[model samples]
Target: MDKVFIKDLEIETIIGIFGWEREVKQIVRISLEMSFDISKAGKSDLIEDALDYKKIGKSIVNLVENSSFFLVEKMAEEIAKLVLKNKQIKDILLKVEKPGALRGSKSVGVNIFRKQ
Candidate 1:
């Protein structure tokens, strides 16, 4: 299967379980890998035959900015579901990072996979 990926997508949104966190927006990094058979698209060399990554990116950004989640796990799960819902995607791996969530650690987040 061919793969379509988006990496280091950063978005600011209201997230976290803490009261202070809910009151403000925090930066989250989202990375996604989706599997699809793009041979047809490649052969045709048509944009319409291929997955529109720009649209996907915009949709994800909207999803993150317009919603609130207390945990990265939930966010990751939702993203996974969204990807799997697309018929072209056979599977997906989603990683979400919350930078500076811990004092000593660089970031904390979750990685999840969903198979269609």
Candidate 2:
């Protein structure tokens, strides 16, 4: 299957279990990989036949910015579900990283997969 991916997508949102976290927006970095068969789109050379990545990106950004979650795992799962909603996608891998969440560690995050 061909793959459509978006990487290093950063969004600011209120996410965390702590009260302080809920009061402030933190930057989260998201990476997504979705599987699809793009042969038809490739042959036809039509934008309509292919997945609309810009739309997806915008949707993800909106979803993240407007929503709050306590765990990165839940966030990743939600993102996977959103991506797999597209019929063209057979499977999805989503990674969300919360930078500087832990002292001395670069980031803390979760990686998850969902199949359609």
Best by TM-score: 1
Question: Which ranges of candidate 2 are over 4 A from the true structure?
Answer: none
All-Cα superposition RMSD per candidate:
0.9, 1.0
TM-scores of the candidates are 0.95, 0.95
Q: After superposition, how far is residue 23 of candidate 1 from its true place, in Å?
A: 0.5
**Candidate 1 segments exceeding 4 Å error:** none
Per-residue lDDT tens digits of candidate 2, residues 33-67? 88978888999999998988899999999999989
Error of 1 at 113 (Å): 0.8
